[model samples]
Structure formats: structure tokens, C-alpha cells
Target: MVGVAMGGFCLAPFAGPVLWRLLIEKMSWNWTMWVLLMFARVTVVLIATLAETYKPILLKRRAKKRGLPLPPKLPTGEALKLVVMMTLQRPFAMLLTEPIVRALSVYMALVFAVLFGFFEAIPYVFTSVYGFHPGDTGLTFLGIGVGLLIGAAIFMFLDRTNMSLLCVFQCHRRLNPDCCQQKSERWLSLPIGLFWLAW
Candidate 1:
């Protein structure tokens, strides 16, 4: 699921420029911007309407299980403030306290910085060096997008294989408890990917 989501995220950059170019040619740039803005607004509305709040449902279930009255709802302003504070503070707290989180955060930040640098460089390189038109320059991003999809597929395959191996290891450990120790090998790919990108 995560791999699929990441693929979709990668697809956007590759698809978006081409789509925008078509929209611009058809509708003019001003109208294209307005159309995209309307699309975003509609998406937000649909999500807000369709998305379920699991927290409230879970609270109800807990109260029912205990044979107790439902808890009173928090005041709207207070609830909003609490949510805002937690959302703002928890990430920083984790980044400071958790080594894995901190490391991943720094890695991702560097990766995105490099990705954005490519976004700027690709156009200039393609246009100036290859004498490509604007549309052709945008097409250069397809190579990066294809690389992202390939990486996602590789990681997804590794994750599924790892899960199967983990289940087998667990079964083996049950039979000979002291002989096996569980270890996560999924993260080995991260540095490998980074090295590949550097090369």
C-alpha cells in the first residue's frame, strides 16, 4: 500500500507538467490555474465529507465496553488548540528523541533537496545544452519518474519477501526459541538507493 502511494506521488511530477502544458495550450495559463485551484478545492471538500473520524468511534466503543456513560466532548476551541499543539510538537519531539526518526528525517530532507535541485536543473540542462523546447524539457523528468517507479517496485518486492521470511523465522523460533533472533533488513536498501542516486 505504501509503495503504491509512493508510486502515485512520483507519478504526479511526471504527469503534472505534461497535463499542465496541455491545459495551458487549450485553456490559456490563467484558466488552467483556475481549473487546478477548483479541482483542489473539490478534492478537499470530498475528503472532509467522506473521511471518518476513528477517534470518536473508538471512544464510543470504549465507553460501551466499560458500561459507562459516554465522555463529554471537548470544547471546540480547546480541542482545536490541543490538536494543533500536538501536531506541531510531536514531530519535533520525535525528531529530537528518536535516533531512527532523526536519521530518516535528515535523509529525506537531503533527498528532497536534491530532487528539487534536479527539477530546476533538468529544464536548464535540456533547454540550453540539448536545444530542446519547453515541452521537451519537461519530458526529461519522465526518466526520473521511471526510476522512482522502478525503485518502489524493488522495495515492495523486498518487503513482501522479508515478511514471508519473518513469518518462517517466527515459526522456527517457536520450535527452537534460542536459536533465532529477529532482525529487520528492510532499511538496508535506503543507503543503497542513496548511493545509486549519488552515482
Candidate 2:
């Protein structure tokens, strides 16, 4: 349930223009929002049927089988400190130290900026180039939406592949240090993609 809600939260901003485009193209912006609200009502109905997963209950049952004592709850202050330490400090450390995470964070930040800039420019571009009204201008955002979906699908396909092959000599032993040093050169692909995407 939480995952679904988070997913919806992440997607909500991008959905705004798409929902506006889907409604009557000539209607006022208020009516378009009303249509969106109706769609949300349908979404609520769809989500009401799902079952919840109770992880704590299952974990306690397994602990009893192993003759382990029940887990103790942390004090409120300790729990808050642990959450802050894990969520902020650990992720910040990883951002600085992990090459893949650093590169991907930069890439995603740039992509989001570009997308927002394109969205901001859409009104000027459509009005100046084609003299399109607001509703028609909203429709152009569909192209951005389609491109985002395509890019996401491509990344999903690449992520599922065993990319370790690119770094390893075989499935058993790791690549030699000499080979790994030379292969580090190929990590230049990240910058190359940025250049290509920029063009």
C-alpha cells in the first residue's frame, strides 16, 4: 500500500498535463481539473481491493521457531536518530563514494532540469510557432510523455541484463586487476551518453 502510494506520489506531477490533455480540449482549465478529480475517484475505487502485507507478524512467528527473544522497540529519540542516520548520512556518504550512484544522480538531475525547461518553453514555443491555445499546447506535452516512457523502457531492458559480463573475464573468478584498470576506461560511456543526449 505504501509502495503504491509512493508510486502515485512520484507520478502525480507528470500526470497533471497528461490528464489536462485527455479532457475536453476546449474546456476551461477548471473543468479539466474537475475531470481529473473524477478520474481520481475511479483510481480510489481501483486501489481499495488490494491486500496488505504484515511483515512484523511474520517476522515474530519465525523468531519463535528459532527460540529467539522478541525484538525490543527502540526509545523514540533513538528511533528518530537511527532513521536520520540511515536515510540522510548513509545516502550522502554513498553519493560521494559510489561512482555509479554519483553518475546516475548527475544524469537524472540534468534530465529532470531539461524536462522542466522544455515544459516551461512549451507555451512560448507553441504560441509563437503555431499560435496554439492553452489546451492545444497541453497536447504537445504528450510527446515528452512518450519520450520519457521510451527512455524508461530502454533503461529497464539494460538493467535486467547481466552487465557484470562487461567487467568480468568469466562467471567464476573476478577480472584481473590489470584488466579492471583498463576496463575502467569504458566507464566513459556515461559522459558519452550525456554528450549524445545534449546533441
Candidate 3:
């Protein structure tokens, strides 16, 4: 419930610029919405057919199906409070304890801002600087897809290497935790990918 709420609301903030970019630089607004609806329909079908893996939830659901009483849903207000508390707590805890995490979060936020700004601003540049048609301008999005694939490849390579490096680094430092190294290495690729998209 919380994931769906936050996912929709958090993503809603960016939807206008996204739709605008599509209309101004890609296909018409009608086609963009049509495609989105199609995607949503496909996603709903996939999720409905997927098997539940959580043991407790699966058991409860099966028991209800077999005529047992179902658990009550949490009250709406209490559910909202729980979502807020849980969502905000762990990140705050991590930020307080981890200097490396704090620094990386700051850097990633800046990179994300630039990337989103570019997504909003590119139509003007592409239409004016390059004099490309909307269809051609939309093709630039392909570059972003390629950059993402490259970043994923880099992350996979780093994941393989991080395990070996942990052993050597552990031998040198008695209590240091390099466990976060893999996460940081994977994240560092975001700024690089953003740079590629901008260029």
C-alpha cells in the first residue's frame, strides 16, 4: 500500500515534464498516453498472475480462501502514520552514522537534479540548436537507454571485483566495514551515466 502510494505520488511530480517532453519532442500526446495505458494494462496482468512468495501473507490468503476469517486491514490513519515513520527513520539513521553515505547521497542528489533538468530542457535545445523534428528529438532518448545498459554492465563488473577487494582490505583494517563499497561503486556509475545523457 505504501509503495503504491509513494510510487504514484513521488512519480506524479515528474509526470508533467515527462509528458511535455514526449509531446514536444516525440509522438503526439494521444499516442504517449495510449502507450502508457497499454503498458499499465500489461503490468496489471503480469502482477495478477505472479505467485506470492511471502510465507505469512500467502498462508493468510490461503486460509481466507479456505473459509477462515481474514485479518482486518489497518485503519487508514494508522497506516499512513506507519508509512511515514518507517520511510523516514532508516534513511535518517543511516545519514547520521555514515559519512560516506552522506557524501554520496549529496552527490547523487545533485546528479539527479541535473539529469531531470536535462530531460525537461532538452526539447528546446534539440528543436532550436539542431532543428530536429519532434520524432527525431525523441530518438535522443535512445541514447539514455544505451547509457543505462552500459552502467549496468559496469555495476556487474564492480560487483565481481568488490568481493575480492573486501578480503584484501579486510586483512589491512581490523574493524573497518567495506560492506558498503559495492553499493557506492554501483552508485558512482549514476553520475557518469547522467554525464553521458547530457552530452
| The best candidate in terms of TM-score | 1
Residue-wise C-alpha lDDT for candidate 2, range 78-152, written one tens digit per residue: 999999999999999999999867876886686567556656776677777778876677777787677545544
- Quality of model 2 by C-alpha lDDT: 0.63
lDDT of 1 by residue, 52-80 (tens): 66998988988999999988899999999
Q: Which ten residues in a row have the lowest lDDT in candidate 1?
A: 172-181
Off by over 4 Å in 1: 1-53, 61-68, 76-78, 164-199
User: What TM-score, over all chains together, does every model reach?
Assistant: 0.59, 0.57, 0.52
Q: List candidate 3 stretches off by more than 4 Å.
A: 1-26, 59-81, 133-135, 153-199
Residue 174 Cα positional deviation in candidate 1, in Å, after optimal superposition: 23
- Predictions in order: lDDT: 0.63, 0.63, 0.62
Local error of candidate 2 at residue 154 (angstroms)? 5.4
Please give the RMSD to the true structure for each candidate, in Å. Answer: 7.9, 8.0, 8.1
Residue 12, model 1, lDDT = 60
Q: Is candidate 1 or 2 superior in lDDT?
A: 1
lDDT per residue as tens, model 3, 1-199: 3223333444444454555455656556687677678868998998999888999799898988899987788999999988887899778988989987787688658756976877757766788877987677766655554554454454444434553466455643311221234457665765786675567
